[model samples]
Target: MSLKSFGAKIFASYIRKKIDKWASQPEATQQKVFRELIEKGKNTKFGQDHDFKNIKTYKDFTQKVPIRDYEELRFYVDKMVAGEVDVLWPGKPLYYAKTSGTTSGAKYIPLTKDSMPAHINAARNAILCYIDETGNAKFVDGKMIFLQGSPEMDEKNGVKLGRLSGIVAHYVPAYLQKNRMPSWKTNCIEDWETKVDAIVEETIHEDMSVISGIPSWVQMYFERLQQKTGKKVGELFPNFNLFIYGGVHYEPYRAKFENLIGRRVASIELYPASEGFFAFQDKQNEKGMLLQLDSGMFYEFIRSDEFFEENPKRLTIGDVEKGVNYVIIVSTNAGLWGYNMGDTIQFTSLKPYRVIVSGRIKHYISAFGEHVIGKEVEEAMQEAMRSTKARISEFTVAPQITPENDELPYHEWFIEFEEEPENMDEFHRILEKTLQEQNSYYFDLIEGKILQPLKITTIPRGGFNHYMKSIGKLGGQFKLARLSNDRKIAEVLEENLRKYNK
Candidate 1:
């Protein structure tokens, strides 16, 4: 092994010891984080307004600080954007991670000097954990690429503003700078398509070992690589063995990715957002990402079913149960207090406190009261593909409450196929059956004739990309929602289908 790989192994071992120390005592670590956040936050404007002085317990904290989403918390964020200091955190944030918002246009989440290390360290620890688990640090010597947004940041009131990935681009560590790919110039390209083409040209001949990005965008990069080299990604980059990804689950895209690479490579799933770096996969054989109990953030959960109810109960780590879906809330050093992250997660292991992101709280289909979530649909797709040997590139589900010919309403699945199934009917059947088995409300609706079985709409190859590009969200942290309550995305995809067929 090279000196770099040898050094990486030693570092990985050191990191693992620290991780194990906290992981083994999840509750105690969390209590420390909770106390630290409260102690520091009490002097801030938000803490003062919320009466943080007398907040002595988790119960007191929850009662005093109601759960608020970005919209509710924006009053203080707007103050920070206007050059206010000590508005949320102890002082002004170092940067603002600009993310696309649904109702609020654009959201600028704070990244404080104290909070930035969590983001950087969590990303680094993800890789080190992988190395420590598998003893595969040789990849450290090869080129690495992370397909992301432009690293060129804009400024708002002297605060740097950019996509979270772009912000992370600035912190790629001194050791990995020599190994990082595409150069800063290529990464600064504004257009994703142009940037990807530039990336393919730059890295085609390099010894790439690790590639990181969202699965969909990275899929585009892989397709471009194949077009240029006429070889599988694994063959083109023989050393490429680790794919680090976040933002979306990888299971649905796994078959298509393995086909493109012509082999399977290990992957690390990360649960990160603009708000904070939350969790990362620590074990290759584990089912979920290990929750970051010691990451300078205090976590709370409300059962997703009761999330909208009046005064829902807030549960901390000790109160959580395995397999039950709960909306994740956090109060962080970044000064988000009792913040509703809007994403739902389910614990897989309570001992070390690991979780799988179930779905977004708002991104579910309950049009017919079935209340189907992203996890259910993703699992069903996995089962259908496994049973039928089909390969799907991408897909989305939306409630079609009305159909032509005055037929009963049903769910519509828009899919782009990598390899069309030999038996489309069988594939559809399996998908519907699996969904029915998992979701009782959906099963009841189908059986009771309130809704028809789900139908599949085949989208042309690259149709999803076309739809995304049409809306100016083709790349860089923009992901297609797996489930929508309305027909907004479905309508555009339907239009794309027509345009493609014509």
Candidate 2:
């Protein structure tokens, strides 16, 4: 191993020990984090407004501070944006992770000096954990490509603001600088397609060992490389061995990615968001990511089924049960308190507190009261792919509540296939059967004749990309929802399909 690799291995060993120490005592570590957050929060403007002075316990906190989404918290955030000091956190945020909002047009999540290390360290430790487990640190010596947003930023009130991925680009550690690909100038290009084309040219001939990005964006880069060289990714970059990704589940894209790379690679799954760096895959063979209890963020959970109730019971880490879907809430050192992250996760291992993201709170198909979530759809798709040997590029689901011929309404699945299945009817049957097995409400709806069997609408090649492009959300942390209650995305797909087929 090179000296850098040797040093990395030693450092990884050290971090593993530290992580193990805390993971073994998850609840106590969390209580310490909670106490620190509360102590630090006592002096902020928000704390005074919310009666944080009298809050002495978790129950007091619950009573003093109600859960708030971005919109609800905007009153404080707006002051921070306008250069107010100590409105949310002490002084101004070090940076603002600007992201598209749900009800509001845009959101600026604070990243303070204290909270920034959690994001950086969690990402770094994920790779270190991989090196430690696999005993392969040579990849650290090779070229590493991170397909991400432009690092360019705009300034407001002395705070740098940009996409979360873009903001993170400015903080790539010194040791990895020489090994990183797609030069700074190339990353700053505002247009994604042009930027990706430039990246293809820059890294096509490099000895790339680690390539990290969301799967959809990385697939685009891979396809461009193949088109240029007419070779599988594995052949072009023989040293490439690790694929790290976050945002969406990897199972649905596994077949297509394997076909593109021409081989399977060791992969790591990360649970990161603009709100916080939540979890990272710690073991090579583990089923779920090890939760970051010592990351300066205290976690709370509300059962997914009862999340809509007026007074849903919010449980702490010690009270949570394995396998139950819960909406993850967080109070972070970044000064976000009682923040609902809008993501649902299920604990897979309570002994070490590992979790897998199950779905989004708002992304589901429940037109007929089925309440099918992203995890179920992705699971059903995985089963169908396995049974039929089909390869899918991308897909989304929307409820078709009105049929022209007086037939019962059904869910419309818009799929873009990498390789079409030979037995279309069988593929459909597998998807339907697997979904029925996963969701009882959907099965009851079909059995009661309230809804018909789901239908598939094949999107032409590049159609989903075109749809995303048409809406100006083509790349860079943008991912299509697995399912929607309404037909907004479905109609766009239909429109793009017509344009593509012509």
Candidate 3:
């Protein structure tokens, strides 16, 4: 047996064993987890403020700690950055995950020595679970090329700061590091164009077996590799059998991704964010990821329909029902109290509990009360793309409610396409019809003439790239908001589209 292949088998076996233990647990395990996190932080200021000492059950915890977004959480984070120990998490945060903010300019989410493993372990288990399912241990023996941002970190107050991907890069096991391509020096290059080129140059001929990154950047890397090698991805990296992706939904890009690879590869979907690594795709046949119940975070759910109500009902793990969209509220070991992750999810299964991200609370368009979301638009667009034989590179959507010069209100789509459909009118018709089918409210608006037919404006090839770079958010976990209630992003892309015209 080859030495590296032997090692792959051993590692894969270990991961599968761990996952077996995690999956075999009872639903009551979630309650035990909630108690554990509360006890872990009971001495911290946040814990005390929330009356964690006396909080014994889900109802008590909910009544004590309220749902909060970044704006409310920033004060404690600033205290952490200014050398406060046990402000949020006990002691200082191990790292601060810095992400771009539209209004606040920057957001710093905490990670602790204890809670950091939740992020790392969920990622490792996902690949391991894939190996278990397919018996593909040889992937472990070959190199992996992760298209991540610069690992270089800055300091805030006293805490180290970088993108979550960048921060996590520092902790990749030494054994894996040897087989990972793109030297840290190359990965540290701040400009994405320069970094991707170096990555292509570094790994084009290696024994690459696994690839991981967001879909957009992965597309860029694949394009660059094809340009350099003049061959399909499968031809370039014959050992490649696995693709790990997160940060955004993959269904919209699935067709394009498959075409780029030139062959089918196993795909694992993960639900990871700056706040925590919440879930992982345990089985390919499953519609949603299995929530990581033991991962140092207690989960709570509030029905999205009632989230805007004066008082929303908080549902515990046992109380949640399948097919209802819920805004996730979490209390984590890192000491975030009743933190609203801002991501919306819906359970596809409740026996062991699995969820798919439905949308973002802030990332929606309901300007005319149509109340549309990311998952709805993405699915509609994918269906339209398929029916029309079109391929979009990137896109964003917003409601055009306020008529300018007495124009009709509509939903505007700013899209960049790798292959524009021959029938633009039919392509648009499908988009409008699919959306009407996805959201009844949207359909009613169209039926009532409250909304004009949706409009599409073609963005020049590099319009999204220009916008991301313009905002200093070109890489890592940053992605263009797919839908918004406002037209700010549409305006930027419209101006970029003008450049092509000129």
Candidate 4:
């Protein structure tokens, strides 16, 4: 490794030490540290000079800044796109991270130098915590493969700015960065075929230790690797130790991945978006421990019960009670004072502030008033897949309401299997039993015969391809909407269900 790269690794090591020290502190001390950061943020030029002067205290901050959705940020993004000054972040945003939302169309989130550090630090700390937990620093010594988005930098006017992943790649230790798939110079946004092909070619012969990316993309990449090498991932990349996945839940894909890799890969979950890296799974063996960037943002949680009530109350992060589901709201360094991420999460423990991501606030199917969230659905699906010994590539649930009949709405499942089951009826029976066992609401509804029987529709090998093609998004970035608990997602699934099932 070059001297510069060596220096970067040393610097990263220093950051890791600081994080470890911070993690070892008492919960009260951590809260103090967070408060200090918020105070510092309030004093920033952009903070005081902007609308943050009114947000002196946590309560004031939450009250004054109403919760904003992505639609509210669209105008600001348009201004940024048009080269307007002082809009989203403090400085001119380097590049916009293009992502889609449940309700909205394509969203362009601004990524600035100030905000980028949070994402980089969160990701780095996640890795460090993993190493500390697993005692696997030797693994870090090997080449790390990041299955990331297109590496191309966007150019506006004369200034060239890299994508969020590209900017993040800049912060990675230079020594390890050299071994990245697609090399930083490749045009990631050119086309899906070109990008996937490049990734396949570059990763075929590398000694990869840590492999990281979204589960969907990584699954596809692993399949391609198998095809190229004429061997499964375990035979091809025998040295891989850690499998870091984010952008979606890992449980559904866990068994299949383990079967292909021939070993139990250490998995880490990251809750990140174009806006920021909100939380990460601290412990590799346990569920996610959400170390809130208290310094970066003030948080609020709307109680699930209250949300369904006529008049809802918003609970501050301090007021959150353990074991109840709540929607998250944030007041961040970015111009977004209070933004609702539209995600529902429950605090598993309050002392260390660990949380279980329940589902999207909007991603639930309540046709029969059962109030089932994504978490319940996911758990059900996973249990079903396990029991039936069926490998699912992708799946979605849609509520079926019959106008002519008074029977409660039923759930229709569109499953894309890795291999067809010989006994399809047995598969369906196992799935229904799993769902009934996993969710009390589903169980009660099914036992009462309020809902119709669970309908299973198995698709051809390229079912997802047809769905993606119909939506004009057939590529690495496209992912199946896991939780269709809302109307918009239901509508999309309805259209696709008609196309595939009919």
Q: What C-alpha lDDT, on a 0 to 100 scale, does residue 118 get in candidate 4?
A: 81
TM-score of each: 0.99, 0.99, 0.96, 0.85
Alpha-carbon deviation at 206 in model 4, angstroms? 1.7
The C-alpha RMSD of each candidate to the native structure, in angstroms, is 0.9, 0.9, 1.8, 4.0
- Report residue 149 deviation for candidate 4 (angstroms): 1.8
Q: Judge candidate 2 against the unseen true structure and give its global Cα lDDT, from 0 to 1.
A: 0.93
> For model 2, what is the alpha-carbon lDDT of residue 168?
86
Estimate, for each residue in 133-159, the C-alpha lDDT of model 3 and write its tens digit.
Answer: 777778777899787878899997778
Candidate 1 ranges beyond 4 A from true positions: none
Clashing pairs in 1: none
Per-residue alpha-carbon lDDT of candidate 1 for residues 359-460, written as tens digits (9 for 90 to 100): 999999999899999999999999999999899989999998878999999999999999988999999999999999999999999999999999999988
Q: Model 4: how far is 276 from its true place, Å?
A: 1.4
Backbone clashes in model 3, listed as residue pairs: none
Instruction: Report every candidate's CA lDDT.
Output: 0.93, 0.93, 0.85, 0.68
Candidate 4: C-alpha RMSD after superposition? 4.0
